[model samples]
Target: MNKIDYKSPIGLIEIEGSAEAVRSILFVERDEIVNTIHHETPEVLVDCLNQLDEYFRGERHVFTFPYHFEGTDFQQTVWNALTTIPYAETGSYKDIAVSIKNEKAVRAVGTANGKNKLSIVIPCHRIIGANGKLTGYAGGLWRKEWLLQHERTFNK
Candidate 1:
């Protein structure tokens, strides 16, 4: 897959995919290196970066790029449910589980959420604790908070 490291407001974001679809969008620390790097940003990745720019600027709420879901069937189901979540709205793990017709899988839902590879586009940050508090995020809670707040502020 072709990859590009984009510097977003939160930090460096690694975008991975091929010319067809985006596979992942991950926040990276300073000096972090991914497995493979692409010298030229593919056409699909250019759209990804542009949309991300609009997202950070609060000019875009919904993402339209194609995505490659590379995970287990359950994980893919959970990820698809995540896309149904409206921008700037929050959902608990229980909510996700219930939406998937497995209300008892709250913990499992959270685990699946934790495994989401794409960040802002897939919108894992929109999921919160049952108590309405922020929870675990691969990009760290601060970035998650920033993303949520960002969406809330510009969700017109």
Candidate 2:
């Protein structure tokens, strides 16, 4: 997969994918070693970068780029439900589990959320704890809060 780096409000983010589909958008920790660099931006990546720029600027609410999700069926279902969460809105793990028609799978929903690799595009940051507290995020809780606040700015 091709990879490009963008400096975001939270930190440097690595967007990885192919010419046809975006694979992952990850937050890169400060001082993290990056061994791969593809300076050339394919059309798809350029589009992804543009959308991310719009998102950070509070000018966009939805993503239109194609993304490739490689995961188990349950994980993909969870990720799909994550996308259904509107911008600036949040859902609980239990909410997601129930939406998927497996209300007893709340913990499994959280686990699947942790496995989402698409970051902002997949909108896993929109998932919160049942108590309405911010919860586990692959990008870190701080980044998750930042993303939620970022969307809130536009939603209101």
Runs with alpha carbons beyond 4 Å of true place in candidate 1: 31-39
| Model 2 lDDT on a 0 to 1 scale | 0.86
Backbone clash pairs for candidate 2 read: none
User: 36-99, model 2: which lDDT tens digit per residue?
Assistant: 4446667787788889988899988999999999899999999998899999999999999989
TM-score of each: 0.93, 0.92
- Pairs in steric clash, model 1: none
The positional error of residue 93 in candidate 1, measured at the CA in angstroms, is: 0.2
- Model 1 — which ten-residue stretch has the worst lDDT? 31-40
Candidate 2: worst-modelled 10 consecutive residues by lDDT: 30-39
TM-score of 1: 0.93
lDDT of 1 by residue, 61-150 (tens): 888888899999999999999998899999999999999999999999989999999998888999999899999999999999999999
| Residue 42 lDDT in candidate 1 | 79
Instruction: Tell me how candidate 1 scores on lDDT.
Output: 0.89
